[model samples]
Structures are given as structure tokens and as C-alpha cells.
Target chain A: MKVLVAVKRVIDYNVKIRVKADQSDVDLTNVKMAMNPFCEIAIEEAVRLKEKGIATEVVAVSIGPKAAQEQLRTALALGADCAIHIETDERAESLAVAKLLAKVVEEEQPGLVILGKQAIDTDNNQTGQMLAALTNLPQGTFASEVVVDGDKVNVTREIDGGLQTIALTLPAIVTADLRLNEPRYAKLPDIMKAKKKPLDVKTPADYGVEIASKVSLLKVESPAERKGGIKVASVDELIDKLKNEAKVL
Target chain B: MSILALADLHEGQLAGATARVVAAAQAIGGDIDVLVVGEGVHAAAEAAAKLDGVSKVRVADNAVYAHQLAEPMGALLVELADGYTHVLASASTTGKNVLPRLAALKDVSQLSDVIAVESADTFKRPIYAGNAIATVKSDEALKVITVRTTGFDAVSDGNSAPIEVVDTVVENNQSSFVKEELAKSDRPELGGAKMVISGGRGMGNGDNFKLLDGIADKLGAAIGASRAAVDAGFVPNDMQVGQTGKIVAPDLYIAVGISGAIQHLAGMKDSKVIVAINKDEEAPIFQVADYGLVGDLFEILPELESKL
Candidate 1:
């Protein structure tokens, strides 16, 4: 069985993003970019599946501009047999991305697909479910742990209340959440070797899927910021403010 | 436009988040309908019917929807989405799980975590982990939206809408429930809690989390933890509050030992009053805090517990 992992290039998690002065969008000019943290976890799980001999070959696919190749290369350095980049400058929504991925799956016929639960940039958390629905595949989302046993895959999900364990048949879609596994960094030597691996690029039209963005970003703005109050010198002072000034006590 | 809002369930009752979603739908000026799907959920359905501005409530009581797993529940939503021009739900785990599937079946894009309903077609959502808010306009004929409960106030119980039974069941053989371990807490739910006390990596260990218990009980505050605390095994994952974890905006949020990483701030920064307690005076959380207390949590917690 082959494993397919979908990765996305997004803003680094550490960066404190700044909204554009015009209220159009977040300023991305010269911003540090990296593989989405959750996407890294997805690729890590896919590579582990290959290491465990459950997957014969692991393929990493990304949908974005040319810079997205960096994320695909990172996936290769971490251990993927090949990389497929759906080269598109258009910022496609989850629906269009899922449709494009469904087209790729039709041709690749991978037994399993792993994706990040949500991209840190968009925080939409919809692509995996949309892909599963479009492809008519069973979906296991927000997966904290996954185990493969014969023709079934057990996915333990980190849910709202606590945890839920669900079993899905083979050829399924699983979206990785946190605590799935600690992703390892690619070694310097592995990064060099990743350049020699096969990396293919295709336009969204190559899959015959329309990449029209369904949502128009009308405006962007920073959230309301709360100004800091004076620091309390003692516990009694804090209590006085909470009871009298803030009235929250 | 006709709108359908799905009632979120919590412990066999209609979740408070449902009213917020209904309010968001009503903001667009539409005939709002609500769907309650679960086993023995008539009480939830009744509560949903009482939500102001809700015109109708559709209840589907079945074992298949007990957990609202994505497979069958998604199919059920798709089946009921025929004539509706808009579908909305609280951006809870169930909403995140099922809305995209319904949108895919209908061949449309879903707007997740909508914070504001600008028009019938336009909405506002927080992207980049609440660091940036994006106002988006959807071109799809049918819009699917998952509302962030924190954005809108819950509609009060004023209406007496009629409740109807939905008899549609889609066969799902692809996935099966194994088991669930829900964190049982007698304190108020984290999202709706009046006071929230969260610990961070500084708490050091799981046993130290008990230090907050007395104060929590005294204040009737829900207990939460930063991702650092959860990662260190000082608390369970469910107690985590951050961008990836549960988003909460309580009336009073006291953060202990948390250095105010952007992720943690994204979850609780919306609290009406934020109090940061940390030993480091230069902690980033102090910038967004309404009140800052600089001290060792171990020493301060004991004193504060006594004072309370």
C-alpha cells in the first residue's frame, strides 16, 4: 500500500504576524515561511507508516506557488519517495484544493491519505474532510494516534471533551492533530539528498479542476488589543482592584 | 434566504454554542431552522426551539448520531441541505468535522469559524490564529458557515418554535465507534465559564495542578492549561487552551505561569478581564493583561487561595 500526504506552506508559527496597513490582508512580503506545523506532523506520520513497512512508497503533495516547493523538499528530506507540486499562484480555498487532491488521488490510487487537521495560516480545518467527501472515502479527523491492523485502521481522535477512538476501513483519510508524534528534523545530509529526488510540478489545469476561489477576502484587520493595567504590588491590592475597580470578583 | 443551524450537543443537552450560531444566522435576516441530531435529544431539540429567532427545530434521535461522527452525520446534513440557502453551526469539534463534508457533497466552499455575518453572502473570520481577522464574501449559492461562539451573544429563550421529527437516515459502514473517554468536570464548561484558571509549564508537574483546585472551587472557575503544561504531562490534552486547543473567552481569566505565547493568547485573550500571574515581569502575557502580578506562582497561589 502507498501513502499520500498533503502538506501546505504557511507562515511560521513563531512569527507575530502583522496585518497590512490598508486592511487588505496580513503582510506576507519577506515573511518567514515554513511547512505548517500540523502538515509536518502529517508528513511525519506518513513517513513512519513507510518505515513500519505498511506503506511501500510515500508521496508528498503540496498545492501552492513555487515557494511551496520548499515544503515539498522538506517532506522529501524527512523521507518521501517523490514529491508532486500542484503549482498554482491562486490562493485556492479548501473546496478547490480538495477537488484538486481528489483528481490526484484518482490517478495515484494511494491506499491511504494523511493531512494536517488544520493549516495554521487559514485555520479552516476543512480540506481533509472535503477531500474525503469528494472521494467518497472514510475519514478519521483530529487523530492523535493511528494503528494499522490488517484491513482496518484505528484512529484515536483528540476531541472536545476528551478522546474518541474510531476504526475505519482501509483506503481512508486521516487528519493528524497534535500529540500524534514528535516530528524529527531532517539532517543536513538528508537535505542534500532530497534535491536529487524526483519533484514534479503540475498546474491546477493539469488535473482538469477549476481553481476559482469561492471566497473574496474583502478586508483584514488586527483584533482588538487590551491595554495593560498597572501591576499590583501585593495580593491585597489585586483583590481591591478585582472587587472594586474591575468588579469581576 | 432560508437558513439551517445545527444545534451543538453537550452531555445530552443543547450546547450554549447553538444559540450563538442561531444569532449569527439571524443577523443575515432569514427564516432560521435548527437541526438536533443525537440519541434521546428531544430535550435539546426543545431547548433549540425556544431559542429566539429560531423558526423550526428538526430532531433526529438515533444511535448512529450519538457521537455525531463525521460519516453518517455528514450524509444526514447533505440530505437535509436540499432547499436551504445557508447552513450554519457552532465551530465546535462536531461542526469542524461535518460542515466541510456537507459542503463537498454540495460542491461548495465552507466558511469556517465565522465571527461576523456581514451580509447573507459575506462573513468575517479570524485567520492566522486570531492574529488577523478576514472579512470574506462567498460566491456560492449555498453558504456553509461555522460560527465562533465567542463572537456573538447567545439568543435568550423567548421563542416557542415548532419541533419536527426528521426521518432521514443514511447508511454508513465505513467507520465505527470504538470508545470514548470524556473528561468529566463538575465545574462550568470552559467556554462558558465565568472564571477560568489556567496553568502553564511553570506548574512543573501534574500534582501541582491540584494547587488550583481550592481556588477554582472557591471561585467556581473552570480549570485549563497552556499547551506547554499539557505537553509536559502536567495536565490532559482536553485542558489545553490555545489556537489548536479550545478557544475560551470567559468573564475572568487568570493565567498562571504562562508566558503568553501567541497561541495561548489566541484562545483566551478575548476574556473580559485577563490577569497574568508569573514570576517573570517581562513575560509577554503582561502586555495583553488587564492586571499583571509578578511573583512565583507557588508562593502566590497559596496566599491567594487563603485570601479567597
Candidate 2:
């Protein structure tokens, strides 16, 4: 079986983000960028499947600007055998991204597709399921554990209340949740080998999917600031404040 | 334009998030029709009919809808989606589970977890765990979306509308309903809680999470954990509140011992009031906090409990 993993490049998880002056977008200039952390887990799950012989090949694909090649290379170093780069500078919505990925799945015909439940950047958490929907394939979303037996894939999803185990057919899409697995760091030797990994570049139009956006962004203002409250000296004082000042109780 | 809003029901009652999704539909400037699907959900459908701006409430009651397995629910939504330009649900487990399948069945893509509707086709969503925001436009004739309830207020109940009971035939036996392991907690549901108290890796061990119990109990707050705490196996995956986890907007959110990562903040930054208690004065959580208490959580939490 073959597995396809989708990765995305985004602002580093450590950096503080600022809204642009126009309140229309994030200030990406000079920001530290890295592979989305959850995508790394997706790639890790795909690579681990390959290691366990559940998958014969693992291909990593990314949809972003040319700088996204760095993330694709990161996935390759982590064990994806080859990489596909769909070059686009525009910020694609989850639906458009899923449409593009669905086309790629049609062309590649991978048995299993893995994606992060949500990118650290957008946190939309829609693309993988959307891709699954577009392809008419079964989906195992927010997977904490995955077990493949013959033609069935048992996926343990991390739900808000608790855990749910769903069995899906092969040729399924699975979105990796946190705690699925810790991604491995690429060893120095693998980094050198990743340079030789085959990386294919394509355009959104190449897949016959229009990248036209439908949503209009009116503004991108900073989230409201929290007002600091005084630390009450005692529980009784806090209660008094809650009942009198805050009136939340 | 007409929009379809799936009213989420749990135990024959309307889920509060359903009202929030209806509010989002109102923002899109369209006539709203709500679908209440569950077993014996007539009461819930009637409740939905009372919400302001809801023109109609379509009820799909069946045993299959009780568990809300995505396969049948998606089919039902797709069937009801005819002639509607937009379909929306709350970004809850049920909504997330069913909407994408509906989108795919309709051959359209779904916009997931939209924080705000920019236009009929455009949306503002947090990307990269709220570290960055992306504005996306969908061109599909029928757009499917999941609204972040935190970004919108729940629909009020004043206007009364007619409740339309629509029967659905659930096809597709390819998928079977499996057993679920829902975490039993007395605490309020995390997504809807007004106050949240979250522990972090600094809590030391799974047992140490008990330290947060008294504070949470006093505040009637939902208990949450950082990804680090979840990673350390100190708590269940559902307790995780971060970019990749559950995004919440509570009136007051308190972080205990959490060295805030950007991923962790994205999920909770929309909170109205943020309080951070950490031993390290330089913890990044303080940057976003409305109230910062620089001290060890072990010491501070007890004091906080007693003070409350």
C-alpha cells in the first residue's frame, strides 16, 4: 500500500505573530517559518506505516509558495520517499486546498492519505476531511492511533468528550491528531540524502482546479486584549469581587 | 439566498452550539432553515423554531441519527441541501464529523472552522494554530462551512417560526456505528464553558492535575491542559486546548504553569479574560494575559482556591 501525506509551511510555533497595519493579514515578512507541527505528525505517521511494512511508499506533498519546498524537504528527510510541490503564492482556503489535493490523489491513487487534523497556522482542520469528501473516500479524522488490518483501517479518533474507534475501508484519508506520535528529527545523514530525493513541482492550474477565492477579508484586527485584575489577598475578597465588581457569579 | 443550518441535538435537546451556527447563518445575509436530526427530537426542533431569524426548522428524527454517525447524517444533509446556497454547522464534534462528508457528497469542498464570514463566499479562519490568519473564498455553488461558536453569539429565542418535520431515509450501510469512550467529567464542557482552568507540563504528573480540581470546582470551570500535558500523558486528548486541539472562548480563562506556545494560545486567545499563573515571570503566557500572577502554581493554585 502507498501513503500520501500532506504538509504545510507556516510561521514557527515559537514566534509571536502580529497583525498587519491594514488589519488585513498577518505580518509574514521576516517571520520565522517552519513546517506545521501537526503536519510533521502526519508525515511521521506515514513514515511509521512504511517502516511497519503497512505501506511500501510514502509521498509528501505541500501546497504553498516556493519556500514550502523547505517543508517538503523536511518531510523527505523524515522518510517520505518523494515530494510533490504545488506552487502557489495565494493563501488557499481549506476547500480549495482539498480540491487540489483531491486531484493529486486522483492522479497518484495512493491507498492511504494522511494529513494533520489542523495546521498550526490556520487551525481550520477541514482540508483532510474535505479531500476525503471530494474523493468519495472514507475518512478517519483526528486519529490518535491507526491500525491497518487487511483492507480495513481502524482509526482511534481524539474527540472532545473522549476517544472513538472507527473502522474505515482502505483508500481512506486520516488526519493525525496530537499524541498520535512524536515525529523524529532528521539525522544529519538523512538530511544529506534528502537532497537527492525526487521533488516534483506543479501548479494549481496543472490540476485543472481554479484557485479563485470566494471569501472577502474585511479586516484582520488583533484579538481583544485582556484586562489585568488585582490579586485578591484572600478567598473572601475574591468572592466579594466576583459578586460585587465582576458580577460573574 | 437560502442557508441550511444543522441544529445539533444531544439527548433530544438542542445543543447550544446549534444556536451559534444559526447566528453565523444570519451573518451571511440569507434566510435560515435549521435541521434538527436526532431520535425523538421534536422538542429540540420546536426549540430551534423559536430562535430569531430562523425561517424554518427541518426535523430528521431516527435511531440512526441518535448516534449521529457521519455517513447517514451527511446523506441527510446533502438531500436537504438542494436549492440552498450555503450549508453550515457548528464546529463541534458532530458538525465536524458530518459537514465535510456532505460537502464531498455535493462535490463541493468544505470550509472548516470559520471564525468569521467575510462575505457570501469569503471567510476568515485561523491558520497555523491561530499564529496566522487566512482569508479564503469558496466558489462552489453550495458552500459547506463549520462556524467557530466562540466567534459568534448563540441565537436568541424570541421569534417563533414553523417547525417542518421532514422524514429522511438513511442509505449507505457501508459504515457501522461503533461504541464510544466518552470521558466522564462533572466539569462543564470545555468548548462552552465560561471559565476554563488549564494545567500544563509544570503540573509534573497526571496525579498533580488534582491540584487544579479545587480551583476548577470553585469557579465551575472546565479543566483543560496544554499539549505538553497531553503529550506527557498527564491527561486525555480531549483536555488539550491548543491550536491542534480545542479552541475555546470563555469569559475567563486561567492558565496554570503553562509556558505558552503559540499553538496553545491560538485555541484560547479569543477568551474574554485570560489569567496566567506561572513560576517563571518571563513565561510567554503573561504577554497575552489580562491578569498575570508570577508564582509557582502549586503555591498559587491553593491560594487561588481559597481566595475564590
Candidate 3:
């Protein structure tokens, strides 16, 4: 069985987000970029399956500008057999990215597809489910654990209150949660080997999908900053203030 | 505009977040109807019908929806999506699982974790873990949205809207429920609690989490943990409070030994009053806290519990 994994390039998680001067969008000028953390977990899960011999091949696909190839190369170095880049300049919304991945899924016909639950940039946890909808596949989202058994896959999902385990037939979609697996770093030798791996670049139009966004960003701004309060000399003072001044206790 | 709000439920009871979703829909100015989908959801449907501003309650009771699996739920929503202008649900796990599929099947875009309803077409949502707020406008005729319940007040329950039975039963063979392990606790849920006391890596281990229990019992507060604690195997993921975890905004939030990373702050910064107790005076948690107490949690927890 072959596994297809979707990765994304986003502003590094450690960088503080800054709104542009005109308030059009976030200021991403010269900020560090990296593969989304959750995507790395997704890639790790796929590679683990390949290592276990359950997956015959692992393919990594990404949708973004040319710079996204950096993330795809990172995915390759992390153990994906090959990579595909859906090169585009538009701000690919969840639905558009899902559509592009659906087209790739149709062509690749991988037995299983894995993706991050949400991209940290948009914080939109929609692409995996949308791709499943478009492709008529069952989705086990927010998966903390995934096991392939016979012709079925058992996905343990991280839900609101607890964990839920579900079984989906072959050729299904699974989205990785934070606890899925700790991603491994690529070695120097593997990074060099990744440079020689085959990378196919394609456009959304090539798959008869348009990467146009339906939602328009009207403005972007920073959240309200919380003011620091005075330090209490003792717990007695904190309790007194909570009960008297704030009246919340 | 006609709006349909999907009711959030737990064990066949309507979840509190459903009321907040209705509050968001009311902001959009519509004839709001609530949809309750689950097996044996008659009581939940009744609860939904009583929420203020609800015009009606639509119930789909079937075993297929017992687990609220995304496949059947999405199909049911698509079948009922013909006349509604907006479909809304709380940004709970169930909503996050199903709404996107409905949006895609309808060939429309979804606005996730909407914090503000600016207009019928415009919304404000937090991106980059609430570090940046983006105001977005959707051009789709049918808008699917997930509401971050903390951003809006839950509507009062008084009105008695009519309840209608939805006969649509979607057949799904792709996935089947295997089992579930839910944490059972008598304490108020973290999302709806009035007071929350969360610990961090400073808690040491799972056994040390017992320290918060005394204070929690005294104040009737819910117990939470920062992602650091959860990652350290000190607690379960459901107890995690952070950007990637449960977003909570209680009347009073107590951070015990928490260093307050930005991701953790995103979940509870909207809290009415925040109190931080940590040994390190320079911990970032003090910056956002309304009251800062510098001390060792091991000693502070017992003293605070006794004083309360």
C-alpha cells in the first residue's frame, strides 16, 4: 500500500506574528519559514508505516509558492519516497488546497492519505475533511494513533473530552493530532540524498482546479494586549484582592 | 436570512457551547433554527428549542448519528442545506469534524472559529493562535462557520420553539465507531467553568496533580494543565489548556507554576481575572496575570487550600 501525505509551509511557530502597516494581512517580510509542525508529524507517521513495511511507498505533496519546495525537500529528507509540488502564488484557502489534493489523490490512488489536522498559519482545520468529502473517502480526523490491520485502519482520535477509536476501510483519510508522534529530524546524509530525489511540479489548472479563494481578508490586526497587574506580597493579599477588589472570588 | 445552528451534545444532552453558537447566529440577524442530530436526542432537541432566539428545532435521531460520525452528519447537513443561508456550529471536536465536509459538498468556503460576526457575510477570526485577528468576508451564498464559544455569551433559555422531526437518514459505510474512552469527572467542564486552576511542568508528575484537587474542591473550580504538563505525561490531553487545546475563558483563572507561553496564553487570556503563582518572578505568566504570587507551588498549594 502507498501513503500520500500533505505538507504545508508556514511562518515558523516561534516567530511572533505582526500585522502589516496597512492592515491588509500579516507581515511576513523576511520571517523564518518552516514546514508546519503538525505536517511534520503527518510525515513522520507515513514514514513509520513505510519502515514497518505496511506502506510500500510514501509520497509527499505540498501546495504553495516555489519556496514551498524547501518544505517538500525536507519531507523527502525525512523519508518520503518522492515529492509533488502544486506550485501557485495565490493564498490557497482550505477548500482550494483540498481540491488540489483531491486531484492528486485521484491521480496517485494511494491506499491511504494523511494530513495535518490544521495549518498553524490560517489555523483552519478544514482541508483534510474537505479533501475526504470531495473524494468520497471516510475521514478519521485529529488522530492520535493509527494502526493498519488487514484491509482496515484503526484511528484513535483526540476529541473534546476523551479519545475515540474508529475503523475505516482501506483508502481513507487521517489527520494527525499533536500527540500522534514526535517527528524526527533529517540527517545530513539524508538531506543530501533528498536533493537527488525526483520532484514533480504541477499547477492547479493542470488538474482542472482553480486556486481562487472565496473569502476576502478585509483587515488584519493584533489582539488586545492584557495589562500586567500588581504583585501581591503574600497569598493573603492575593485572596483579599480577589474577594474585595476584583470581586471574582 | 435563514440560519441553522447545529447543537453540540454530550451523552445526548445539549452542550453549553450550543447556546453560544446560537448567540453568534443571532448576531448575524436571522430566523435561527437549531439542529440536534443524535440517537435518542429528544431531550436535547427540547433543550435546543428553549434557547433564546431559536425559531425552531430540527431533530434527526438515528443510530448512525449516535457517535456523531462526520460522514453521516455531513451528508445529513448537505441534504438540509438547500434553504439555509448560514450553517453554524461550535468549534468543538464534532463541529470541526463535520462542518468542513458539508462546506466542501456544498462547494462553498467555511470560516472557522469565528470570533465576531461583523455582518451576514463578514466575520472576525483569530489566526496564528490568536496572535493576529483577521476580518474576513465570504462571497458564498451559503456560509458554513464554526463559532469559538468563548467569544460570545450564551443566550438565555426561555423561548419554546417548535420541534420538527427530520426524516433524513444518511447511510455511511466508510467508517464505524470502535470504542471511546472519556474521562469521567464530577467537576464542571473546563470550557464552562466559572473558575479554573491550571498547573504546568512545575507540577512534577501526575501524582502531584492531586495538589490542585484540594483548591479545586474548595472553589468549585475545574482543573486544567498547560501543554507542557500534558506533554510531560503529567496529565491527559483533555486537561490541556492552550492554543491547540481547549480555549477557556472563565471568570477567574489561576495559573499554578505555569510559565505562560504565548500558545497557552491564547486559551485563557480572555479570562475575566487571571492569577499567577510561580517560583520564578520573571515567568511570563505574570505579565498577563491580574495577581502575581511568587512562591513554590508545593508549599503554596497546601496553604492556599487551607486558607480557602
What lDDT tens digits, residue by residue, belong to model 3 across residues A183-222?
Answer: 9999999999999999999998899888887899999999
For model 3 chain B, the run of ten residues with the poorest summed lDDT? B295-304
Q: What is the lDDT of residue A39 in candidate 2?
A: 95
Q: Is the docking of candidate 2 incorrect, acceptable, medium or high quality?
A: acceptable
Q: Residue A185 in candidate 1 has what lDDT?
A: 99
TM-score, candidate number 1: 0.99
Better of 1 and 3 by TM-score: 3
Best by lDDT: 3
Q: Give the clash count for each candidate.
A: 0, 20, 0
Candidate 2 lDDT tens digits, B105-149? 676767778888767888877654565566777778998888888
Give the TM-score between model 1's chain B and the true chain B.
0.98
lDDT of each: 0.92, 0.83, 0.96
Task: Answer with 1 or 2, whichever has the higher DockQ.
Answer: 1
Choose the strongest candidate by DockQ: 3
Better of 1 and 3 by DockQ: 3
Write candidate 1's Cα lDDT for A27-117 as tens digits. 9999999999999999999889989999999999999999999999999999999999999998888999999999989989998999999
CAPRI verdict on model 1?
A: high
If the candidates were sorted by their lDDT against the true structure, best first, what order would they fall in?
Answer: 3, 1, 2
Flag regions of model 3 displaced more than 4 Å.
Answer: none
**Which candidate achieves the best TM-score against the true structure?**
3
- A242, model 1: CA deviation in Å? 0.6
